[model samples]
Target: MKTSLAVASATVALAVLFPFAAAEAQQAKPQSWPGIKRTDLQRHDLSAPGREVIQVHVDFAPGAAVPAHSHPGEEIVYAIEGAMEYQVEGQSPVTLKSGDVLFIPAGAIHSVKNAGSGNAAELATYIVEKGKPLLVGK
Candidate 1:
């Protein structure tokens, strides 16, 4: 997939695992994310009409990856454990470690891989349109 992190990076100022995964979570079902584990900690409807923010916690097995995907919201990521290789379409891959931050724009295709010997985890905050799906697998 083209590394398109630039738009997402710029937009955070922008955009998870799959459409069904998000759908399942929304329905309060157990969510299964390929190559990773996730928890939607909270969803806050913004005061701005039609906007909302979601907090997600994710963990990837060492060397595991979430395939190319896009979202309908801007994602801001903060690394929590180990390291991750984040690539957005048309952009150079960025290695994010604990305490590092990244921005992803809505609808920008991207992929993330664990880049360390141990599992990697991150916190993602998404600002998105109300009622829109969180992820779309490519």
Candidate 2:
């Protein structure tokens, strides 16, 4: 298990447990969702425009990374090749290999490092709240 947070609403039963729990669950699901290639993601159903959602295919050359950044929305990264070390603000990093997943909550400061010896890649599906931008450069 990993540290997480969730948005909650009174109408949502799970929200009753803890407001943050609901947000965590909602944001966390994307990290574990099935993934496809960048081309495939282009053909998949995407959230409405202006709603702030994006599917990104991140390819790395041995040790490349997307760089450190923060976002207004929750993000999920699914490893498509090799392995990756993921770290969030104030937490120990975790490593994941092909088919592995990582969940990052909204506004969580995080970074990704490619740990594989060869070429590596990851598919990131970013889910953000309405009207929020998907990715912010560090």
Highest lDDT scorer: 1
Candidate 1: misplaced stretches above 4 Å? Answer: 1-22, 25-34
Which residue window of length 10 is worst by lDDT in model 1? Answer: 9-18
> All candidates' TM-scores?
0.76, 0.60
CA RMSD, predictions in order: 13.3, 14.5
* lDDT (tens digit, per residue) of candidate 1 on 8-125: 6545521233554456465432244455888767777999899989998998987788878887789999999899999999899999999999999898999899999998999999
**Can you tell me which runs of candidate 2 are displaced by over 4 Å?**
1-50, 130-132
Error of 1 at 33 (Å): 4.6
Task: In candidate 2, list every pair of residues with a backbone clash.
Answer: 5-24, 6-20, 6-22, 6-23, 6-24, 7-23
* Tens digits of lDDT, candidate 2, 42-96: 2233456644556768766676665566886778888888888888888998988
lDDT of 2: 0.64
Per-prediction tally of clashes: 17, 6
